[model samples]
Target: MRPAPSDLEPVSRTAPADGTARAGRSLPRVAAALVLVLLLLVIARLPWAGDLGMHAATVQRLRHSLLDPGNPLVDADTPSPYYSPWTLVLGVLARLTGLSVFVVLRIGALVGLGLLVTGVLRYVRTLSSHRAAPALALLCLLLLWGPLLFAWSGFLGLNSLALTVSYPSVFALGLGFHFWAWLTRAVRGTAAWGTWVALGVLWALILLCHQFTGVVASLGAAAAVLAARPARAVLPRLGAALASGLLVLWLWPYYDFFALFSAGADLEAIHRPLYEHLAARFGLVLLGVVALACRARRDRRDPLVLFFVLGVLVFAAGGLTGHYSWGRALPAALIPAQLAAALETVSAGRRAVRAGWACVLGAALAVGAWTQAGTLGYVVPRDRLPAAVAAKYRTPWAGYQWITRAGVRYGDVVMARTFPARQIPAYGPYTVAPGYPDVFLPDADRRAAAVTRYFGGSAAQRRGIVREYGVRWVVGPESLAGPGLRKVTAGPGGQVLYRVVP
Candidate 1:
């Protein structure tokens, strides 16, 4: 009654009906990959590029670092940059490949997403109940999860990193990382060569990319592998993986978190409404129950159920704090739910049963594809960029460029806020008063005051800034009717340039 990929049989529903030969096997695979890739690129290339701007900023800095070494050109300071190094390589690699920023982002989106789907599909074939694992895990996940992730990832740059976290949870709960590592080591013929070293480096790089998630993934993988090995072998395997983690930890101090190192994947996000978390766990349990019921009563040998059950209990208990705390625990829920869905397929009774599950899974996949490829993706992103207005103020990047072109010397202690300092491009060798989020880390109120005093001040206040910031020239986008602005440029997002005439 064991349903495994090694024993996969074609579904009986559409089996060579009426003696018509099955469609060309080779074609569908290629077609599926191409359609998905092209569609993903389109969604990623749109003007908004979603939250990609934030990541682009991050990658921009990392890219500049490679060339300047002394001064990486990334926007300084961000809120949550705990694990940016791991993914930055892709950005660096994209620049080297000579693609535009848009194309490079699209490339990472395609590659990362493509690999994610691959992992799902492969697991689906494991046939727990014919529901979940690599092939994209059960069809419902394929349907709903794909569309949700595709649509969200296309619309949110931060979501890309979120997916980076979610993908490894699949591996942690599905294939078992420790098993893969052990296999890598066991194959001395393979391991003796540089393959081991390369894997080590690759693993380390991934850890660097999204340190928190990467560490969680590594721990989950190592644990899964350890569980599968002999009692004696478990200790050795555990030691090796831990050592690898330790080596990286030595380089980056934050890797020392025990929960992250222990049950790290469990807390991957900060989703709220604690009740929702409970509901999700309950749903997975329900699905797990139904999937296990399809198997022979004696087949309780499947530890997949227990894996999911324990995960549910632990995560629900942990969710109480995940909202208030740094949500590093959400990944735990994703694994069990995926397994329950994908593994459900193996219990198919006849043609109808298999067809039923496939239809469900197929619908999920279709919606995912449609969401990424749909016309809805072409318009403004979920978060409106306040454009036409955004266009008026010279971006901070552009403003700095303006000063260089004019050969003007901006004084020390200029104020900085994304909107207020939109005109301030790259400023060098000068400290600003109210500064970029990277440097000053001020709250919105302080930022607002600085903007009010510098760009939006009354004519008298503008005159007073000479005493405030020690600079005579003030140039930025301030609302025309606002207190102290003389219009430099106007549209929706207007520009104001003033010189304090004290």
Candidate 2:
């Protein structure tokens, strides 16, 4: 029987045979570049929203105390998962350059975006030598998701990437793509022991950088390895690599990497949202599903199909077992499907089929782009946008910089509502309770109760709560005034700042 048409066809056949075709191929590349530049500009703005404050606070702590940054959210000396290898490097940059934490994050965003773009190109090249494959794959990876706009750290939809470009998730994901590419090449050829060990170290680094993306990376790597069906001789090298990676995870000093496994219960509530609106969130990738089915028909060991299957199993188990944190692994399935769709469109043996796939993909991409058009509000004035686009834009949260400007110093404990609590730490002050969950902070529940009492309890109880936590400031509405509280200033959204008077 004849072998199936090689997905890894030579560049000559993949590239356009004529000037017009070459121009057509070049168009997508140019569009991809423009999209990247727009993302960079969005990074420059660094709109404040979910987890940005937490990350900014993490950098601030690391900048001040690299080895002992403590808990990023509350005023406590505890290890935090946010103190990963990538954040540590950013912390050092903040300390060395005397740049603000947000500026450091912008720099980090540029680096992450560079890694992601180049990594995608390299990994896609391993699948298809087509000159346009990388460009098309980039476009698909960024835009090929369901019509509903979902923004999360690990998800790579255009709107999501715009919001989370500066996050460690992006950095980890970039490394993940490179990991898949390297693993693919290593399994196919002879590799030195040192090379395998280095790969192990890289894997550990990716895990430490962003644990969720690390899960996705692990699944992809496993797919690549299993699809290769390595010889007996390669098993020893694979073992060495695994051992090295485990060693790194064990030796990590900032936090107990294994401790995170037990913290899943605390995280499941927040992650449940990941499973909602599945069809609206990922419907566009069905095209890729078709592509994977085609590939699987020809070769049962197809890596993308294996990766998707592994991701689905983990995700389904999460939904069934109330381990919603595992939902973060959805990207592991989505990415391969998205890439497969892009590759099959360009590499189909017949012109008619390729054109049909391309037309479908092109239409899907256009719809996806419109769904995420609200991201343009980050670069352009929302009012200037068309009504449809403007309506899609969700305003970012205002920062708590006013309280900081009013003299709330580092380590100052502020009693605030949940919303303000989320943003205050970015400016160096800690809230009475953490804005997000804290697995390591032993007094999280008590702290939360204290915050609640301060807000709604009797005056005497409020005093007791303040004395217990050493609260120096109170942030709330003007109606919150009392004898011990003196108004300092007002903030956005009618938030009043009050200093505790002895």
Candidate 3:
């Protein structure tokens, strides 16, 4: 049976009266954090960068075809058979708002941002109940910057900013924070059944969002529970784990998610230097380490602190082993925990010293977030098409617009070398044969190469490529026209569409 609202208050181990007081006290910090998160999200206007467009397209497909027999996810004919609960939520939002999936993608980013801030605040509170630490640590998170080890690198702060587009990863990281914090309470015997239920729900959500993230969170949860007094902690942890497992089994293809563990094991090593991974929160890592050393004699065996420190090392190792996402999630899971610990260690300092540290931390986070936000100021627009045509495509903007309006159809395979795969779904419910790059899609590389060949290959090669991939229409420069292909429409600029000869 579900618990009553009154029952929920005790879950936090705070009496009703005390809980209200704490909530009142925390409200200002939460409000300020909310403003900061919203500001970063709004300023970034995080567009469809990277593979976000492909995910948007999936949501588009789901929105239109949920009841249709040709639903891409259920149909075995489609190239991608993967599942994404996040896209399902986006689909529902798109329907409710009557907005395009592209817009919903940005909204998802905003939601992820809010959750991330909430999780960070919860995490910081675990190490220190000092009222100011959440605000201070969060400010540093939003504004700090560290040295860039290379030209094409991102810091931890930048990674958070990029959360504007990485809905799954960001959402998972946010939930992982809450999961760890809840697990901390469960292990300490301060939590009620509701807390275990909350942890399980959060874990289930993370699993549905992304399997790799679920694995990382599961490790952290298991560590926290195991390190606690096992006799007392085992039942709650087991209950939470069972609830999570049952939820996963009920809502998702749990086995498929498990298979993802070894999916990219064979890929070439793309190892990042330790500095690039840690630079974003290098200051926190340094301060936390220094504080840990300074208090080694007294606090050396702190379970929560040790878990997070080991997390940094584990994720660093995972990155070295070619799991880049694991590496990126490290700072999200560990930094706040370490920062909270650092603050607790230094809480005995004079007021002036504490204020000075806070100021320095805030400035560094601001610089980092601002620097990262600058990179996204002019990212791809959220419109159905880019505002202007590129000279390289030699196509007028109207030409593509006409193609989108006249020739595109549901599930039609459109081929274009210069046009982005994202544009097809944005403008019409069509698929790009070799569309945007998605790590999950097996045929992404093969189809991407075929798109190149369709535009540049000889007549026979183009036909073979077209037949092989079931190319419905080719949209590109007129010069690339070949036999067995009749011009459907020679629109303005260099835009020309050819129907594949049956």
Candidate 4:
């Protein structure tokens, strides 16, 4: 199945006819392209916070020293994989910039997007000599940005990066791809010892940012090995890359790599039709798959083809398992690989066919841009808190404003309807009863159930919830403010805050 070395040479080297273009004009074009990418990312991110509440709560706790040194997540303090070092970086940036964490996150996301573009370009340069290949690839990625699957998955490593600032997986994906470009060079004996060390540090950083992204990177590297073939030439370098990745696990012994697999098993019982489950991104995905097949047929040794194959596997894994995150890694690899294939197809085609394909790709990109704009329109369109966040805690508007004015302190337990229980902790320092939102916690479900009963059940059940959960205060609409509770505050909407009697 291996193509002759001559067929592979064009992929690895610039065509002689374009050597002058590569030498004289490439730098200017590349610089211009990067600037364009950065600007687009900035514009796309003007509206922020897709799911800002949970992550904001975590950052708030850490930044304000509300968290115990040992605990990172606010209500659920137990050690888990979600405590991200990148979150700390964002917190520190907020401190230094004197900006809202939201603003800092937007800037940080833009930087991550830029790095991702650079990584894609480097990776594409390794597999194709076409000067416009990198630009075309990035444009395609941006055009795909606003589609539901890509946006929810963090804009497929484009300008609309990260579903929210709190989740660093999207940013980590960018770093992971950048790391892959370096690893490929190392594996091919083209990178220096320093480059290998840098890549190792990069791997460690990705693990700290999000463990799942690290897993995705490892899979991509495996795909690269398959594309390289003839193990002897690349084995030593591949070993170096593998060793670098493994070194991180050794250093971070607390990392429970198997933990998420078990946790994700919970999703297996829930099923949806493949198209609906994939958010209707299947058509674009099919096009990518077909393009990759064509690229492979042209040259089986084309590394781009293998990379796209791995992307499809990741996308399919998510669909099959009902785990959206499993396929979240698709954008980083798929965007560049698909673009390269498209460019190659256009270059190899007859005049009429080439123009038709170009127009099709161009139109797809335009549609994606419009989709991105509309999607972001829904993200942070207004200055006020989102209705989703507002509805999380159905406190009357006046009652919640009163709590905010009263300065709800850290660790203050408030008993209320536990529907969307993350609200109080997310918006204020006060802890809520049934604090455990952890999937891994053995008592989480029971606690949630008990809290639910307290809100709607008889007075006897309310007392049991208070006694069991150490209820300090009860907050709700006035009608539920029964006996043995001292109403400390009242609101125009008939909401009340009552202190639970001893």
Candidate 5:
């Protein structure tokens, strides 16, 4: 049974009579709006970094061949997990509008950002009636991390969001917040069979878009259902929803969603970093941990507490078993704790307790903001930034557009080293080997070996690799001179572009 209104702490929903008090209440909203605007400008700049090329390559493939867009990074006909429903839609937009992949990503960033902001507002309303809960929750979500600035696709810290706003992960995460809100309402109130089915389909789409974020979303959904404590009648509806979701996953023709489970061995190494520096990277969220404990004490089935527990269990299992990829679920644990801290600040009954919580949260936010202050360099000129803020800024990678300018065309195979290979495919050229890991591609190992041999092997070995992959162009440093190779142009970082001789 739900608690009586009188038993719950009073939430401030109306502006105070005093003008100063009204203005003070509005400050958080204003601050949050300003931060969002800064993020929008950052999206416009679209700083090039990790996985940008991979996503760009996906869209580029879909644009040219919607039906059979093949492998995104390599010239193969294998299906790819990256070709999700979201990217297919993006591919259609890029084709119809004749826009660059980056331009399409910018549009996607706008939509994803809007979804995220409104989703937070909608979900927070279910937790607290306080007028400031949504704004405070947004702030806490973005700034409740420790001083070390960590940037990853599924993570939602300010710096991380800035870097990954254009990624499918952001769109998946935005949809996840909405998923939680919808599940909460559906479980709490009577809903038709159709509603449950729709919710199930939405859940599948989230998973298809970004698998890591999808895991986080699934955990949040489970927490919502468990906390609602539905009656026996709801079990059938839940089963129907599960069936619908599994059907969609099975029917997704682009890639085998279930097959991804077997591919975990290839991913553990890359995700190992997620397990490192936990205290330094996420220590500030301990405030939220305290708040979650408070909530759990009052109600054992509290959704946030359950969410945190589930996330910790999975993350701990990953570390113990060397399956570090499960660390992507860290946000699942962090998010509820952050929301709890924000909600407690506004709903605490005692004035002294509220004030103390606000002070600690405020100090934590200040430190976090400074830790992510380097984000300002995305909008402001780096040279114009203060020394302290500028010191934190890491320069984004300059792209491989230079090779394209020298006549590298779509579907043209370019022999490049690992770093250049990572970025070149973004401009529509195929690399000899994929820059990132590819679980589905059967010849991934062979392709990688071919690239290594072409760069460091004997002349006969280089010729054999070029012939085997049909390489038309090669990109490397100035020292990369050889017979049957003609210098085409130079790019950033003293790199030389070479074309194969007939």
Candidate 6:
């Protein structure tokens, strides 16, 4: 089923590896993970958003089982899942050991992120199926870790932002979908891939544990389903994808709100004559269509191609419409499209093919090489930690692991945006907090006031709003813990208790 790699032909895969080199190759991946892991660990100290630090801390507590497991996500503020179960799991493991919960949380977030990057790399290699896939995979992983990480480093918005649309969580969802797809297949008396089922269960457990990932994962399963199967199986797989998607959407309350809220937006915004947007949105894809026209004559039914098509369609529609952050969603399709391009580059026999491959290859190499450098002079790579803080990470409970000869709750029922609060609630049975991305944590009236304060107004208006929100001590990640708010005793992340001045 694997394609062969081509230096000239447009369609090729790597030759099947024999045991020795295959086994030996593991070292490079290990080395890559180690490199990224260490860098991410160092980045953690440089002020990861206060919230990301908190999430790390929460992961620490969960690993220790310092709290009950069932509490939902944190902070209803700013529209996304704050909890990341995969990161939390690693934190839990660290808590079990003697490592600082802060270290554990930071390390775990980086490790999970690194592992997700590895998964993308392996997926790229497998999808490319080439000797060069390994090289390309590493390069792409490096791009993500290096430039992307650097660009998003301290800014820590949703995409690279800890709770904001973390793409790795989507990676988890893809893993979960693959699992459930196999489970369904097995139940149907078709070949069952227990491996997928195991993966699904593990991620589902993680999703249950944290909400941020759960949201992205929920939507990403449909895209991953195609990756797990070939054409003849597309119908069944699509159906499976649809069912899984529906299930995921139903479980979380946010989707409905997002959908509803988006619907409420000026219908004019949603209804922009489809043509104006689609043309701009799918300009690249239309070019791909030209490529497809050239390739279709040769007879192709490639999974990566399918991914490209679906991704293009979704990206175009999203950009054209007001659907959930289309740019972030674009990556699901981008991965496959990029891999297909990489594979085809080597596959084509033309001398020009090598030139084209060289460009892509060079870019990927740069991603790997400069992942840690923060350059305002340079745009940060996607995978590396960011050099600037667009917003400080906040989640109070994530910091300060309780050193209990025996465990005790401090009798504080603090509410937070999402992740750390989710983790913290479990720590103290008496503590109450938002279930997930809670609206209540940040006062609704205040958010309204904040909007008036920050939006569609003069600079003076924005400052007033910022000050007003800060004064209430109710807003999140932004104004909640600023200058007007005084810090009390701190946790590992400087998890501070800011009192609204009387």
TM-score of each: 0.58, 0.96, 0.72, 0.73, 0.96, 0.52
Candidate 1 structure quality by residue, lDDT tens digits, 147-174: 2323222111122323322222222222
User: Which regions of candidate 1 fall more than 4 Å away from where they truly are?
Assistant: 1-35, 43-50, 67-83, 87-91, 94-100, 121-142, 145-204, 215-223, 226-229, 252-289, 292-314, 322-328, 346-352, 359-376, 379-502
RMSD of each: 9.7, 5.5, 10.6, 9.2, 5.6, 11.2
Report the alpha-carbon TM-score of model 1 versus the true structure.
Answer: 0.58
- Scored against the true structure, residue 211 in model 5 reaches a CA lDDT of 96
Alpha-carbon lDDT, every model: 0.40, 0.91, 0.56, 0.57, 0.92, 0.41
Segments of candidate 6 deviating more than 4 angstroms: 1-47, 50-54, 57-99, 110-114, 141-190, 193-300, 359-372, 375-502
- Reference-based lDDT, residue 66, model 2: 97
For model 3, how does the per-residue alpha-carbon lDDT over 1-502 read when each residue is reduced to its tens digit?
A: 9998888867666676576546644753674565465556543554334445446566776577543313231112333322466767777777777886657767777776677778877876776787766765565454443543122112235443553334576667677778787777777766666666666776777776765566667766765665565565458556876676666646563124544555554332343444354555354445455544544445654555555656767676766676655554455344535454436433736746654654554454454444443333333332433333221111112224466566667667667763445455545445434343334455656766777776767888887876675668777778866677778887766668777776
Q: Write the per-residue lDDT of candidate 4 for residues 46-81, one digit (tens) a residue.
A: 433334444555555556652342233234455545
lDDT by residue (tens digit), candidate 5, 1-502: 9988765544333333355446546977998999999999999999999999999999999999999999999999999999999999999999999999999999999999999999999999988998888999999999999989999998889999999999999999999999999999999988889989999999999999999999999999999999999988888899889899999999999999999999999999999999999999999999999999899988999999999999998899999999999999999999999999999888876867877888899899999999999999999999999999999988888998888888999999999988988899999999999999999999999999998888888878988898999999999888888887899999898999999996
- Candidate 5 lDDT at 196 equals 95
The backbone clash count of each candidate, in order, is: 62, 0, 7, 0, 0, 66
Give the residue spans of candidate 4 off by over 4 A: 1-50, 64-76, 92-100, 129-131, 145-150, 154-166, 230-233, 253-255, 267-279, 314-337, 349-353, 376-403, 416-420, 427-440, 471-479, 484-502
TM-score of 6: 0.52
Best by lDDT: 5
lDDT (Cα, tens digit) per residue for candidate 6, span 300-397: 54544554566567656766665533433344443444444445545555747655755555554444345333421112233443534312223223
Comparing 1 and 2 on lDDT, the stronger one: 2
* Candidate order (lDDT): 5, 2, 4, 3, 6, 1
